[model samples]
Target: MITILNSDKNEVQKLGDLKPGDRAEIIGFEKAPVDFENFLHRLYEVGFLQGSILEVLQEAPYSRDPISIRIKEATYALRRAEANLIQVKLCE
Candidate 1:
């Protein structure tokens, strides 16, 4: 996976890199997956839009395959693979 450096010098981190209680702003997606278009559509439809605020609420106890996150007032679980595709600018 590719890590991005923000123009303002703030660290850009992958959504999967965040731990519980971490908050960030969605920036963009990284290397496109096979169904990139659909992925983007689904993410946007579910409120994973750019500039949206995201908070990591929990992670699976064992494999951590699915991570629970909050966006606005809604919560959703995303697989590590899908999370990695999302790039975010960490909130201080």
Candidate 2:
């Protein structure tokens, strides 16, 4: 579970819950439920760094597994399982 503080309110959700066109910023990670114990380092390497603002661009409608997100000046597809590790603050 990810806890997001937005506009003085708290919104708790996992990265997999975001839909296309939603805007959010990377907060950190949730250690226990992630793919593995030490997946944080790999996530950071793939631009999941803190304070980065990301925009959801698209998602596989049928499967909803691989979602496309835009971060910085690049784009990447991330699986729902992989995305769950990221904690984000949704913009209102």
Candidate 3:
């Protein structure tokens, strides 16, 4: 049986809402108005595009900065703006 995981409503509000210890799968990405395709391609090159698995490692206290996350075998820090483009399905 395929079971869908429940996600936090607030945390899934936007890409910037992801927090530490959250497990999620990338579902889609929001296209930026300027340089939209370029932006998407860049994210794909960095392993943040569609079908990616993400694990939040840590977030800043202010919650207005970058966040540390794990993708595949690499850990990366992304600014709030960049993260906001990546949509995800939170894993329960």
Candidate 4:
């Protein structure tokens, strides 16, 4: 289900910014305009929900539009535009 959320203010990066093998925790969603809220809701339902741990498994060799992310035992492929809506804290 979708819910209201606010992104973290510090150490947070958009998922599209992650390089392969990078790790991060799902902090929340970037604030969206009322019209764009539905898009964030869809992303949330796709396992980008708060507190989920994720890793950048791979990036497309070419345009890098669709990136692969692993959360627990499942892998999710997301478009860069969709990944940009999710906020994450990069891990060292």
Candidate 5:
């Protein structure tokens, strides 16, 4: 699991747990699949870097598997499993 302490002692949480309208700062990544390098590369390419602020835009009402998040002026849909790999600190 990824562990990065933030100011104010807020517990770092999985990005998948964020609901619509919630904002957070990317902190780190948890252990990922075998092709972790490739996965990290893709996430970085899409702006999922440490310290980047993102806002939850939407999610599938029933399954909540695919979540839409806005980062750096762009929005992208990510699976809950994929999002679970990202650690974040909630923004007040």
Candidate 6:
């Protein structure tokens, strides 16, 4: 059984630091805007849904704003606004 762990505020880290090809399971969101529902729906459309597996591809220099990620065998570039809302646990 998969145990769902809540993301602790102290555990927050930059998504860019994740190694390429490493997989993680999304758990919760942080730094969400006031229009959280809309923002979350958009993320879901781009494959950032809860329980989805994500693979970090690359991070741009000087900014983690645009992060390249692979989900469900498809890749996408997400802005910081959306990336910040995604919380994940490193897969072993």
TM-score list, all predictions? 0.82, 0.75, 0.74, 0.73, 0.83, 0.64
List the candidate numbers ranked by TM-score, top first: 5, 1, 2, 3, 4, 6
Instruction: State the TM-score for model 2.
Output: 0.75
Worst 10 residues of 6 by lDDT: 8-17
Every candidate's lDDT: 0.86, 0.78, 0.76, 0.81, 0.89, 0.71
Candidate 3, residues 1-92, lDDT tens digits: the string is 99665446324445567768888888887867786678667778989866778899888677547888899889888887878888887866
Position 83, candidate 6: lDDT? 72
- lDDT value for candidate 3? 0.76
Least lDDT summed over 10 consecutive residues: which range in candidate 5? Answer: 3-12
Question: What is the C-alpha lDDT profile of model 4 across 24-80, one tens digit per residue?
Answer: 988888877798788777666776789988998988888976899998778888887
| Candidate 2 local lDDT, 15-76, one digit each (tens) | 76788998888877777554465666766776878888888899998998799999877888
Model 5 — TM-score against the truth? Answer: 0.83
Model 4 clashing residue pairs (backbone):
none
Please identify which of the two predictions, 2 or 5, would achieve the higher lDDT against the true structure: 5
Off by over 4 Å in 3: 1-13, 35-37, 61-64
C-alpha RMSD in Å of predicted model 6 compared with the true structure: 6.1
**Per-residue lDDT over 39-66 for candidate 5, one digit per residue giving the tens place of the 0 to 100 score:** 7788899899999999999998899779
lDDT (tens digit, per residue) of candidate 1 on 1-92:
99785564367888998888988999998877677778767878989989999999999999876899999799999987789889998886
Q: Is candidate 1 or candidate 2 better by lDDT?
A: 1
Q: Residue by residue across 1-92, what tens digits does model 6's lDDT show?
A: 99767554336454544656667788776766687878678778877777888888876677745768998888888765567667777766
Candidate maximizing lDDT: 5
What number of backbone clashes does candidate 5 have, counting pairs of residues 3 or more apart or in separate chains? 0
Instruction: After the best TM-score superposition of candidate 2, give how far the Cα of residue 47 lies from its true spot, in angstroms.
Output: 2.3
